[model samples]
Target: MELLHKFSFRLLPPVTFNFNHTRLASLYLSTRFPVSGPAFSDPGPLFTSRRPLSSSVVSKAGWFLGLGERKKTSLPEIVKAGDPVLHEPAKEVDPGEIGSERIQNIIADMVRVMRMAPGVGLAAPQIGIPLQIIVLEDTTEYISYAPKEEIKAQDRRPFDLLLF
Candidate 1:
């Protein structure tokens, strides 16, 4: 199977800001680059020859800013797009299992993994779990890394943690 990833490049017009009068504005210029991964099986091995969904520029920036530097986390490898688990319907979380240790641990792990991925959201199936659980957070920290115009265009803003 083939894995395709799309990246958008945004260009902004220059803005002059005075300390006394600060104003931020930008114009959007976007271009898409389609990155194709090497042919692989539907159910590939964990973290093998997979192209990351994020852009190389972002990755490099993160590295330069020390955002990429981190101790190894024991979280499960994020399942790739072709994984059957991702395509199938996830089982509903049992009400009785809501407060169970396993569920709590999964939620914790999900949050950790999502933050480490620096993504806004993640689903249980993305971690190879077949439960209907999702974790999401949009923090000011994450937004700060993005362009002001892009954030405004998307109406993006910090949001409290959400789990279901």
Candidate 2:
């Protein structure tokens, strides 16, 4: 329809995908497994060690806090494990719909999820919306506990909610 024509899908490869064939689409995607964190160093010819995740490079803040604890709340489900949509670019939001009830609700839900996850930001594709909307907030939780030197190096102080 009109929406489909308006939004173009950046087909990853094999330029002949038949979207109408749900079975083929699912089968193709099913073969691929998602790896979240950084790549593992090869332990041997046929083995890879996943223990050395590069979180250590994240800085003193990540080492101290350990990627904020998730507390249950009215948060939307975060699409995890690097789904295909995560790699797909989001569409632009229609200007006229910016202040509509649906858009406002989506924004509220996204903000709630970000705070609950204790994450710095959340993008629309993160939640599988596929629209160019992002919500961010700096709670300053890390800055509070970071050493003076670390604080001097990077200042991520609390900031007001941001919507885009």
Candidate 3:
């Protein structure tokens, strides 16, 4: 029994085999030690010829590569379309009002809300306030690929409305 055990272990050496070697060895071993399990009872087919998948498979690959999903932009509630306040011209905000602690607190709050909404620009009118106050930030500035001359011309405009 010990000799038989040693021979069995020797026949199935534990060397790591490449894919082709593994397949060939499995084929050789099948003839040597034919399994009598339910899985191999009928032996349906030995091998099926494998060809590259059709162009339909390429479509699946292209779908993943293209990333065909549009990003949704979220705007602030106060500055939405059809708001009466948005139509009304903004009132003049005194520099003194801007310096006030209350204004500072409001600005901080607005900044927090803007960050949460991920907005590029926010106006006081959007927040139900008629004050002529606005803040803007753009996250796409770094990757924007506009021409330098055009960007400079846009910078010369009254407001910095160029989207980087």
Best by TM-score: 1
Every candidate's CA RMSD? 25.2, 24.9, 18.4
Q: What tens-digit string does per-residue lDDT give for candidate 3 at 9-109?
A: 77667665567988978877876735787667886855455865545556557646544344654433555688888788888877767789977765665
Clash pairs detected, candidate 2: none
Candidate 1 residues 1-164, lDDT tens each? 12222211123345555544322222221322234533332435544447777676777675366557667668887899899998889999999999999999999999999999989999999999999999999999999999999999999989999998
Q: How close is candidate 3 to the true structure, as a TM-score?
A: 0.38
lDDT of candidate model 2 versus the reference: 0.76
- Give all TM-scores, in the order shown: 0.54, 0.50, 0.38
Which of candidates 1 and 2 is the stronger one according to lDDT? Answer: 1
Q: Model 2, 1-164: lDDT tens per residue?
A: 86655444432233565677887879789866546523433334444567654554554364556444546455568998779888888899999999999999899989888877768899988887899999988766845766878777775467888998
Q: What's model 3's overall lDDT?
A: 0.64
Q: Which stretches of candidate 1 lie over 4 Å from their true place?
A: 1-73
Instruction: Tell me the whole-model lDDT of each prediction, alpha carbons only.
Output: 0.81, 0.76, 0.64
- Candidate 3, poorest ten consecutive residues by summed lDDT: 155-164
Which sections of candidate 3 miss by over 4 Å? Answer: 1-76, 140-164
